[model samples]
Target: MIISRESGFRHDTKRRGQSMPKRHPVNQTHNALEDEDSCAVYTALLADQGSTRSELRTKARLPLPVFTAAMEQLHRLGLVERDPSADERLLALPPATAMIRTCGDDLRYLAEKQERVYRVTASLSPYSRVYREMPSSGGITASGKRLLNRAEVGETLRDLTAGARGEILTSLPTGESEELFTLTENALRRGVRLRALYRSSVQFNQSSARDTQRLIRLGAEVRLVEDGFTEIVVIDRSAAVLPLRDDAEGALVVQDPHVVHFIVNAYSRAWAEGSAFPVRYRRQQVLEASDRTKHVIMKLLAEGAEVPTIAKRLAISPRTCQRHISEIMNRLGARNRFHAGYLVGQRGLVD
Candidate 1:
């Protein structure tokens, strides 16, 4: 039996009638300069620099086929050269020199590839501009407003937030989704200033409280308001998104500079009237926890909100809400609920 070292193969040399050890096929596929066969041949040649090809195969202990393949690959890599003075002898180049030559070739190839990429992109620039200027099927209106269905709002908001370089102002009455929470986190990481406004009653929602706290920790400014406010998102004061209908079935994306500026002004006014959200954290907390529920109740009462409505908004029982209302009425020395609310505003309590 003949055994090949690097290839890990055993060749049986027995006749048909004789019992012999297991035989395996020889490996002939690998011929790269880095393979074990090439490495063995190179090392042998290094030890005896001016050796002939036949002497290298004998010293390397590699089969003739493997030795020939390894030598061809080494020559291609400039690691082996013909010794002109010696008849059939081979000369081994310094490994460092060969590596530098190979790397220079690879770098030149990569530079050419990168240049081709730039040229291809430049050729397509005009088509990209044309695509952006073309109108969508039914999403864009004549007024330059794009209509987005409920399913498209999240995608559009993601794109807008990703591209936003300046401040992002948002007023959402129904609270934000977890997907939006993640998207906003990414925006905040990019150093974009964010100011979000939500209904004061959202403080009672455990989910919203957790998400809002995380956002605050990431340098977002949040506020709570009790009075009327519209749901909108103003990005960079250049674009605005609003509900297309009262039911929130769709959205209207406005990019008209004048319309966007108007929305921005309205948002600014509402934001000024809002109260800072009480973040439960260390020194980074925005506001100290106060009787915010009572304050909100006062505002709702002034707005003529009923007992059940106030209770639902505050996430409390109606009986508990009535008790608070009674306390307020007694403290004001008022005759009726409406009269108590009148005194609350008359005394400038909600301010």
Candidate 2:
């Protein structure tokens, strides 16, 4: 006979003529194996087949209290059972049988819970219908807001971008999405001014970089921020859509004028601070710092600043500073940093 517990209910599966069902060993470890003392008790009982609790405890060399606890654990795990014939005698189930019984119990419990959930859901479905059909004042809902699922969010974004007239401001994370690229492209084609912020990490992703390059080529202004804010889209400074929560696949669309204005202002600040996307220069084009960066580097070099000092002053890496120094030397036909500084001073580049 085998015993199992499902949702605190016991089930008995009896077999004909209990010849101590063939003990089939299982190579896989069970949760019951985690307890050393319980494992010791189970091992001893498995070897001896049928032994009184006290006899097995003595054979296992465990104290009474410890053995009792181990036996309790074994019982809970369905590995050991009290003999129906004798009060103190016990029987050890085959490892495979115990595993099967335990798994069946868990499956039964889950089935019961799933049935209950289905019942509850069915009972509330009418209420869900009523809520969906509930009337609104002036056909208006809660503060010009809509909660949209993943698919709906994409469709709604496409609609918003297609209808946009003035401008679109968007913040993107570290991955590329075909939906975003398509919508952004459509908006730009309508002569809608679009400023997009992408996480700096996105530049490292080949596909996302390609998407960004396509957008830039289509006249969409793109910038990279150290940490991109949550994925958002603001259309014509009148509406904003963002994720409802980090873990949720739904989005929240907000159209309240005040709220939209706040989101647009916040986006403006981030855009102002974000760095322009790096230009992919052609082979013949020279790589040099921007005019402002070049002017600062020139001033620093004239001050006899080291590479590290120049880098810190310009918020760049020493390697980049050194590269700029080399470019400046080549540009001025100079041989070294000292000569570069002399050329800059003579050309009044810093002034």
Alpha-carbon lDDT of model 2:
0.74
Give per-candidate clash totals: 0, 0
Per-residue CA lDDT of model 1 for 173-242, tens digit only, reads 6456777778888999999999998877666567888888889999999988764377888889888888
Give the per-residue lDDT of model 2 (tens digit) for 282-322. Answer: 43322222544566788878877788877654445688778
Clash number for candidate 2: 0
- TM accuracy, model 1: 0.48
Best by lDDT: 1
User: How high a TM-score does candidate 2 get?
Assistant: 0.42
* Superposition error at 26 for model 2 (Å): 82
